[model samples]
Target: MTPTTEHRPQMSVEEFEELERHAPETVRLEFINGKVQVKAVTDGNHDQIVAWLQRLCMQHRPELWLYAERGMKVEAYRRGRARPDGVLAPFGFAKGHGDWSEAEGVLMTVEVTSHDADTHQRDRVEKPGGYAAAGIPVYLLVDREDRTVTVFSDPEDGRYRLQVNKPFGAVIDLPDPVNITLDTEPLEDLAT
Candidate 1:
């Protein structure tokens, strides 16, 4: 049997975008799992973690750029909007795109867990389903609480078929399409 769309978004994508645009600069908003979520302001360590990954991506794949907090239309049927910590795509892929760009050319989406109560549900659970459903090639999660990197890939039927996890200091291969290897040693330093 084919899959079905069980739930509708709390508001249309247009309404969400308009609301997001008018929000105060300090407040970040996201639509996920049919709810308008106030995304927590990232901490310094979170920013540094993204930066380290950005440098590594640029070093290994000069043809690609890791756009920070790049808004993306994600989830099945593009029902959700997320500003991933890092969005890896071909250089200049979003040159002319608006705030919410299609997930079409995104090679990978990364999220570094924040010190928020909602992080476990939002990042560890809901986000993987959303990114997989959007057909993104890979979802890389840097879990600060766990000090582990979990890579989710091979999306099918709105779920990733593969998942690999490694501790902070271990080497992790991000896989094809996003063929960058990470020596996660630096992550250990950033986890604090």
Candidate 2:
């Protein structure tokens, strides 16, 4: 499980940034729903998958920019902000630090599950609902616990209407706006 340092009961964006700025380089944290949630320290295995996803996404569309560790700019309170494991933005969409990109136009947000139960819940439940509410077209979740990959699409009224899940080593087909099939073969080892 990821180590959590809950310094206070509720935190505003200002307070979250203050703590995040001074936090150690190794710490991975996100401001979600008035709470600051710490993520598990990333490992080499996790990093390898992230890097591979970036490269593979780029191959799918040279024009699109697939960014990692990009903070989701959600306008709603409490579930205000989230940092997706991988964020897909249109060509020239800002991915630079401090330049917040609105949730719209984000093609997809990927959440690779961690060992932490809190983090897992955040990924499986909180983030999907939040992303859908923001009208993001897609949410791809790599679930280590389930050893499967799920693609959520067609956001309608704060939820995804369609969800397709496939086990590792299978091909996950994405629909309109993002026409590509992601091969989950390489991710099989991470599931194990």
Candidate 3:
């Protein structure tokens, strides 16, 4: 079941930016539908998976830009901002370069599922729609408990049309824009 919403006070983009600027280094903040959310520190499994994936991606050197837990300000229709876990940019590009905004074109994005099912649903359902509307090519979800990875691609009509799910030890293939393969064995090992 997906997460339901509740009534919350809304803030503008400027207010959100102000909060982000004042936020402590350890506290990660994201804006969703004009509401600010503070992200928790990752667990051992989350950290391990992030590090392993980063290392694999670096070795491949697909010219794709990878960011971990970076703040991505994506444009949404009714909701103002939507940020994913990891955002993959086109090759040979760097985010937050001079005169660049977080709300830039993204090739792919990833989200690691949370313990809370509602949180998982938020990433799996809500963010995907926002990303698809933003024209992102691919979205990946890593379910730590389930030891599965889901790849969502082929966006049509402002939503993803194709979905691929693979378990641990499976070789996952990224889109052409990011031609890289990930072996889930290391991730599974880390989960243990």
lDDT of 3: 0.68
Candidate number that wins on TM-score, 1 or 2: 1
Predicted candidate 2 versus true structure: per-residue lDDT over 15-100, tens digit per residue:
77778788898987776656778888766767787887888878998888778878776535434677788888777776354734
Query: Which is the better candidate, 1 or 3, if ranked by lDDT?
Result: 1
Preferred candidate (lDDT higher): 2 or 3? 2
Against the hidden reference, what TM-scores do the models get? Answer: 0.95, 0.86, 0.79
| Candidate 1 backbone collisions, by pair | none
**What is the model-wide C-alpha lDDT for candidate 1?**
0.93
Worst lDDT run of 10 residues, candidate 1, spans 2-11
The segments of candidate 1 whose C-alpha lies over 4 angstroms from its true place after superposition are 1-8
Winner by TM-score: 1
Q: Write the per-residue lDDT of candidate 1 for residues 25-93, one digit (tens) a residue.
A: 999999998888888999999999998988999999999999999999999899899999999999999
Clashing pairs in 3: 63-91
Clashing pairs in 2: 33-78, 33-79
102: Cα error in model 3, Å: 4.6
Residues 1-192 of candidate 3 have per-residue lDDT tens digits of 965555453677767777778879887666664467666657777777766776777778656556776556554543445446677765545534531235456767888766654565467666777667666788888877778888888876768888889998899998766677887877677654
